[model samples]
Target: MEGICFLPTFLVIWSSSTFIVSYLIALFEHDVDVIFPYISEIGAKPPESCIFGLMTIITAFAGMATIYARYKFVEKLNEKAGVPPALNQAAFWIGMLSCLGICFVATFQETTIIQMHDAGAILFFVSGVLYTTLQSIISYKAYPYGCSLALCHTRTGMATIAFLAVSPTIICVLLHRTEDKDYVFHLVSAVSEWIVAFSFIFFFTYIHDFKRFTLKLRTEFVS
Candidate 1:
């Protein structure tokens, strides 16, 4: 019951907060003229880059929400199963470091590259990988928590669904009007989306089984 209650709350907060923050950053940080390179087009002088950025940002935040909610619920479950707070804290910190490493690499690339949008997609893909890896760590660490298994599974499920659902939509929309189907740019985008989609799947399955294994333990104990 607690898991159910906390999961939705964490999801709502994390999703809303991250999306708002990322949207504002995209609006100011990205310049549309670079990608579109047109002077007289729809909504002249408006930030077209922000639209795509918003889409990506929203997608990312949704995933984060799922991860956060799952982590918290799992933490509670671990507590019930005699897991120590120190262990959870250690695992969480390690996950944070992993996530930071990916973000830092992406930041370095963004700074060095001039035409960063395409490369940025690679970074986003990396980010998704790190995100999943961290969630997997959390799920694995909380194995003693019985009810937490469900939340852990939910987290992976949501992340996988979100990425697979969002990436193709984003790619198809961006590439739809583009005539350069054979261009290297299109190829890179396709590859990046594929990487992101599969990473999410890997993380989902990994975390789901981790949770289920823990739940199985709990069930045995109760029986």
Candidate 2:
């Protein structure tokens, strides 16, 4: 009980501090490269640096809040019977091992075995996604666990596809005209698109579930 009481306080402070720092980094780091001629550029430099700085800080805080909330939710689930520590530990170890294996395989491959390295990377990601999905099914199906499972699946797919899609485009762009920054920006855009897509999917799913739940409650009351 006492432990639960401090969770919220820790979350508030952790998220707030991270948000401020992230916002400042984003604001001060902006350059002409960030601007898109067709669309408006956000956080463009202005005379009132403090205003943007504050906004940046708040945005950073909000990002940190998401992570903080996730941690708190997982902790609460552990307190409940949602997932045992052993299962959680196993899933973590498996994921870590998969990452290490992929890194090792990639390191050994020279230019002649680039294809092999790529294959290993793909296999690694696929196994990770399947492993996470299975683990989620084995664990109790509740708020944080279920949500984390969905997020993992979504993020895994995004990462795999984003790398595949962006890598070729970046390589091609670099081949034609060399600009490291341009390639990086394009890669970032591809990843941002995935995040936006997932956000919309999550938003609609939540709304649909809420409506269905409301309907069920109304039916029960009427009966």
Number of clashing residue pairs, candidate 1: 0
| CA lDDT of every candidate | 0.43, 0.38
Residue-level lDDT of model 2, residues 73-192, one tens digit each, is 444556544665555555555544444434433343323354554454444444444434434443334545344456545544444453444344334434424455465555554344
Runs of candidate 1 exceeding 4 Å displacement: 1-50, 81-123, 144-189, 198-223
Q: TM-score for candidate 1, please give it.
A: 0.38
Q: Which ten residues in a row have the lowest lDDT in candidate 1?
A: 36-45
lDDT of 1 by residue, 33-149 (tens): 233221111112224333433443444444444444445555657645555666555544544443443333333333244244334444455455545545545554556454356
Candidate 1 local Cα displacement, residue 208, angstroms: 9.4
- Which runs of model 2 end up more than 4 angstroms from their true locations? 1-44, 47-51, 79-145, 148-223
Give the 10-residue window scoring lowest on summed lDDT in candidate 2: 208-217
